[model samples]
Target: MSGSTATTTPQTTIRIPAPAVTALRDALLRPDGRERVAFGYCSRSGNDLLLTEVEQVPDENHRHSSPGSCRPTTACEREFISRCTSRDLHPVFFHSHPFTDTAWFSTLDRQLIDRFRKWLTTLYPDRDLLFGVLGHEEMRIERVTADDSRPVAVDIKGEWELEQPVRPTHTAAPDAPAVDTERFDRHLRAFGEAGQTKLANTHVAVVGCGGIGSILAQTLARLGIGKLTLIDPDEIEVSNLPRLPGCTHGDVGQLKVSAMHQRCWEANPDCDIISIARPVQETEDYLKNADIIVAGVDRVTARYWVNQFAVRHLIPYVDAGTVIETSDADPPQIESMEVYIQTIVPGVTACFDCLDRGDPDQAYRESLDSAEEKAAVERGYIDADIEPEPAVIDLNQLAAAHTVSAVKRLALGTQPPVAFRKYDDVSGDQALLETHPNASCPTCLGNSLALGDSTISSAADQEIATAPLDDAALANPLEQTDRTTRDWFPPAVTAFFASDLAQHPTTDP
Candidate 1:
């Protein structure tokens, strides 16, 4: 009689969810524990498998067995196997590794595997049963056979290093919209055929998915940005509904990155969206590959992280913020709404530190003072006491649109506006402040280009770049200033009035 040997294909290894690992570790720590240590295996989906449930095994505690020993009762075994089969999950043999250093498997481990093999063979003769060795420091997986053989260690490290799963290219759902080839062509042209080629190969990271960020992402997607990494831990709140487009009431508790991914896909299906639902600290690897970073976060902590990351990587970062205020005493009186846009080109523009060092409280103080002034106006006049209706959606949308336009201009090699535009509805006039970098700005003092080998010689040794201002022509307000004036209109004003007689000739200011 001739005998044939059966060989099984190697099982693909995947990362166990961190939570599940923690749960298993916690289970092993119990002492008088009748706790049922349930184990089930499912094929890897994306990063990890969803651990469905764990049922408690009663009166099955093995006190005499090793601390890690998972000697499930006959009933528990049958129940586990039944549930796994119903859920189409495989019954990887389950055993506990007591928190000990002994490298070799105990005799009990072999006996338990033998018992499980007998049952697994009857149910899945062709398939191998997986065995998990859960220890204090590590967890090991192996395969078992019916011949009362020792388990084979699963190579976890080797498997995890393999490339990501190759998903079908056209796996998009049937209801998904068809590709817009014409818009794609237009996007390519707008980014410059050569530029679009470069951008397609580049990866961009957006730190926040708020008002400015949402629009920024939309613009990038429409521009055919090849790869995008979105990092945000916030959920869509009711307060954010007015500013955040593409978000609905249903998305109130949903992750910002998920919402952003949906919007990006709808904007451009070809663009890749890497959604990171965790905080920025937890997603450094995603930040490492970013070619350009768009900072639309309102928090100082988040902005600091972005600034540090951008400075370290020499990546260009565009920062945008808008402040809207209304007087308490005046109805329809917009106290002031100032919009600030700053572009920090790694080696070119002064870093944020440089600007902050000069006048640390300048921006914050200015914003606060403006807000207070608006509040005062609202409180001073009895007519203003009447509460003004909340801002309309169009106002926030208008701000976001301008911000997105600015980002596009920067990406297209156009110089971004440096003047902070203050729209004052009460005075019916707009104030423009030329936000020039202070020579003593601390942020810029020690800044050295990331790409260059040269280091900053000394804080005082750095030279400041200055541009000449044409103050003489603007001195006479009666006479029209240069025709090339950028108007900063107040909220309720009809006519554009030049605030100062002098026009700054140099673009630096």
Candidate 2:
């Protein structure tokens, strides 16, 4: 009678079907001998590993051949996880190392293991899972339990027993609505739908297809932007994948514009994707057709060029930049992620020249000068000689995102941020929207902020006198200086003074 009262415990053994393993092997062997293996596990009770839900390790190829190096690709990882989630499968990824016999895991390998354990614990603390790390000839298995104890190895009958290729299910592509459908549907019913329709009709142009530009293009595409024009002269590089969205290791060496076009189209086939694989200077004509232009460039020279084009064509240009400086500590720490966003609406707010001058080197020098001396000057200084260093991708992307948000605000006819906005280092996040009434700015001369009557009259007089008096006039240096000063000074000075000149005229005039 006592023996008849035995109780049963739940079994935790995970089974990976045989057919799935074969498919994974085939997939890993494709694209010549270079292809690598990756897999995911799915389970309902949140304990058994579902081999049907597998994924290719992101950035796995780089460290695949090495013992402990790995760089995961975000797009690939996201794609893998999304597909699995859609099928109601939990994620447990598998990747291979090319080494034949590496007993100890490398730093990268340990880091990856640590990351996976942490992620699983955070997402599913009650679920037990297993992570597999396959070597060139040996397979290693590590089991993760609900408790934070050491992972133990489990022996399988065969190495390739659970290898199977799982293809992503095909579904009809969803329509991209212009508006914020998620938030709208969640909040307002009819108005949100209507707003989305309006958003679908907007078009955007991104200038610069490097790190920031590429990511911006993808974001806009995914957000269901109606039309997009991507411009860039450089080709993709292997190093760009770590930062740029929609790009893979395979995309390296391809034209950035072309890659972006392909990727955007893939993301939202209905959205228009135009490619301009040339410098912005060469594609000025195309820019006129855009409703909004985003400048995700590195050079101040390029920014100035964009500024001129945007001003001339009355296009809303959003300029973004990042300045990264390391501290002088034993282990250098990034001083700050100095992200900046400038929205230039031709006749609305202060243009780039009105916010601040384009020369960052000059700004840096000014920052270093004695505070008393720097403050004593009435007219702001200009460093015609300062050349800024090349900008990096993180700063560029952050700035681009800010610029896109600003554009969205403008497109929606919301109160756009004041004309000139600067997010200097983090502390300077305040929006400054001052306008210049008497600004003799070469950039915005005929627009919202007109030059003073005296400045205009002076300019007219100089133009008439220097109006090409035949070859004899060209021989005088004074004539050259006069013409050059007239043409360049107002713009240069306007940039230095920002919107301050609108309050009071420069005494020098």
Candidate 3:
């Protein structure tokens, strides 16, 4: 994946879909005591490197293999590269060392990487390369640039656990003191210091600082979440005072996120809160870094956009909403009151599109320019006056509570990562429904899944495409380096494996 490399030290994080993780383990970690190779395709979005698909090399096609040496047939390597270039995706090379539990690149591994890097640069000068060494217990990834290869964070997007030994180079703020407060004594007692620490290290983005969102922000703060980002564009109204937290008649015209920020600080003064008083679309850079996203917006259009964003970036998203339907009779009477919470674990769970819950028409109308929207309204494509939806604080609270519970489960790994629950006030019962993602979902499957920043058109893409190449690695990403004394295997073996394959002509998949 090649893009505009950050002038600042780039902190790269790798996100692999759950199924791709399974495929890698099953294909490369065979019971037989021998090394194996595989390849995957990925995209670079901002600081994230997302893997979308994985392909294993069949044993019959290997040119050579042993406990410490492995190499795919020349055809296999060429085919993999072809597929990646054809799809505008980057190739991620993987090799497993079943002999050990710890993973690190060997001298031979570096040699092979450099050869491929030099070869690929000749084919596509601006392209980037990624190489990984997989061990039984841990994995190591190297981000190949024109100048040097550095370690990057490799995190699985779903429930399956993978240990990443190398940490990315991202500066973190000072440790939060919220978890050590006397106010969270009971909370610490419930989950222990380690759990509290996990919450403290987490950063959550709560979109839509309205009834449910305000409650979520305050509750997350009180629960010791170290960082909170409150996002919304609306201002408080007289009608919103009852449902909004820390709001009064005097603050009726202020931005909802500002009031929610104050409310969260009062709940836990040590918690860091950022108020983004703008539409969610304009805040992708902030949202991409969040460990979790909580969507509390009222419209399906907004929810749909959030879901799409979450799926593309492989961010966990929790969606919460409340519905209060009333009869349009002489004297309106309540028909139903319901609270719903859906937890989306990117590749692991069903998305808004899979659930068929998003209104494409409404989303389209919202995406239109003001004049276009007016034309649409005049054309009878949408309602000229959309009546305000009925909302009650009690129901919003119930939704917020459930949504927070889902967030807790995700943060603590206390349960399955996926959930869809509903509470019906009239029926006096709650139901937990199973979610199944559509096989053909455009948002969370195939080419779009885990595409990262490249999935959306942006100025960065143009910058990367036209940026001047400043280093030879930009022309040839991997570097050929000297051998080390700590070779796990003989140098002769590594040399044969690295040079023998490149001699053959390239072939297509």
Candidate 4:
């Protein structure tokens, strides 16, 4: 279906739920001599589009055009108009080619598409028609504008049964031409040709860039995600080298998002990486538009916000964390090291809030969002926590690996939508348990707009020009209030603090 338009050449991202895509592909796949076409409706989210449902024009309702022209039977035509024309839903038409591996529109095919658009205009004059050719193990999508056809990235959330192409198409452009299949040959055996395509089209957004987030980004790149968005505000430190893959001593002071963005690009030059050096809260649009969100933030509040935001946007989410607990026994033995991965499919699975709702620590977790609150905990003002939890690279890596796998499975619909996968190091125990949605959960209840929110725009407004990471802190944040500040105080209030602290600071001696 159609949605709002953006800049012309680079078409908007098309988001289809994983299953919807699988259904569409299955419906379109056919014998070489036979013919078929599939159509569907989709809602919009900002500049991006989505595929909401698909229905095949039954064989009885359409004529086969094997090596020839084909048209819908009168009955099929009438049904299409009745169900789709009046609503302004964008109509996507798919047809198969006799040959496999690759596909291109012929002169007759072009004429047919033009005629179809003309017929569509009689029903909805302003509607734009979308077209696809299901070639051998491959698919090509185009936006038929009044002037020309524009290519758009078709991002399917979760996983899809790929079209087993007769062979891998030359999936590259001339200017940027390079060998594409050699690197993924190993992957092809596991996911098959179709799965690799699905992986290539998946758009994943990672909300943190620390140990867990960095590992997740790298793994997703290696997994063949075509596009990735990284959202984080922290910079790398010497201490980060222990766990973050691809981050070396040379990158010690770079922005975590920027460094990891480079690492992913170097891994898969085919993938488009959008690096946002900012907190997820400041950049909600990325989370909303991504096919899936991999939550890797350190703060509980950030995770809480991501769950709600993801639910509101109907995006799949994978969140994970690791904790190490030790006992004050005679030998001060390591009591346990636990890693947990939580995956959620909005409206389908139990969201993070649903799980937190039943836990007594929810209130405490909710309150620990602020730097001051964290400082208080470190100072023992909060009794529940002795201090900040220690971060280990191996633990973060273990949890990230599981979370990334879950992220892939969530997109593929192979795993339970709401499940907690836990690993205990000391006890050598592993469990994956299904989680139930809260009966009174508001988000699950308010599934009024499934892929219907187009008001939230991308991060253009929230985007800050990403600068190369400086070795030093660059400037005191208090001193650079005019340049940047998220200090939780108004400028005037900060001024008051400056004066108050200055007046009382002689006691520091």
- The numbered model that scores best in TM-score is 3
Query: For model 1, what is the alpha-carbon lDDT of residue 83?
Result: 58
Question: What lDDT would candidate 3 get against the real structure?
Answer: 0.77
lDDT of candidate 2 over 460-507, digit per residue (tens)? 344443344344323332333466575665545534644332232224
Pairing residues by index, what is the TM-score of model 1?
A: 0.43
* Residue 47 lDDT, candidate 4, scale 0-100: 70
Off by over 4 Å in 3: 1-11, 85-88, 114-126, 145-149, 160-178, 364-384, 455-509
The residue-by-residue lDDT of candidate 1 on 1-509, one tens digit each, is 00011112223333232333445545553554322254654432222122212333433433333334446556656766665554344556444545532223457666767776776877677444666654434445555666644323221211111132111111111121333457768766555564555455446788788777777787778776677898888898898788677888999988888998999999978888999888786776677656567766665656655665555445557666555676667465566655555555432455566456223233333334556757756776222333323444444454455555544544443344333444433344555444433466434334422311222232222222122334444344333434444143232232232342234333331
Per-prediction RMSD in angstroms?
Answer: 26.0, 28.6, 14.9, 13.0
Span of 10 residues, lowest total lDDT, candidate 2: 1-10
Candidates sorted on TM-score, descending: 3, 4, 2, 1
lDDT of 3 at 122: 70
Q: Compare candidates 3 and 4 on lDDT and give the better one.
A: 3
Whole-model lDDT per candidate:
0.52, 0.55, 0.77, 0.67
Instruction: Identify the superior model by TM-score, candidate 1 or candidate 2.
Output: 2
Candidate 2 has a TM-score of 0.45
Pick the lDDT winner.
Answer: 3
Residue lDDT tens for model 4, 1-509: 22112122345656555555567667766654455777776555667666656887777767655544455676776666555544535677777664544556668778887877666655565555788765555556676765666666665443422343121122222122232678988988777765677677678999898989998999899888878999988889887788788778999888998999899999888988999987688887666667788877767768877887776566778888887888778765677999988887654457787776323354465566678677866787666554656678888888888887886676554444437888997799999877656767755444432435433222331122222333222332255344445565465654455432321111221
Alpha-carbon shift of residue 243 in model 4 (angstroms): 1.9
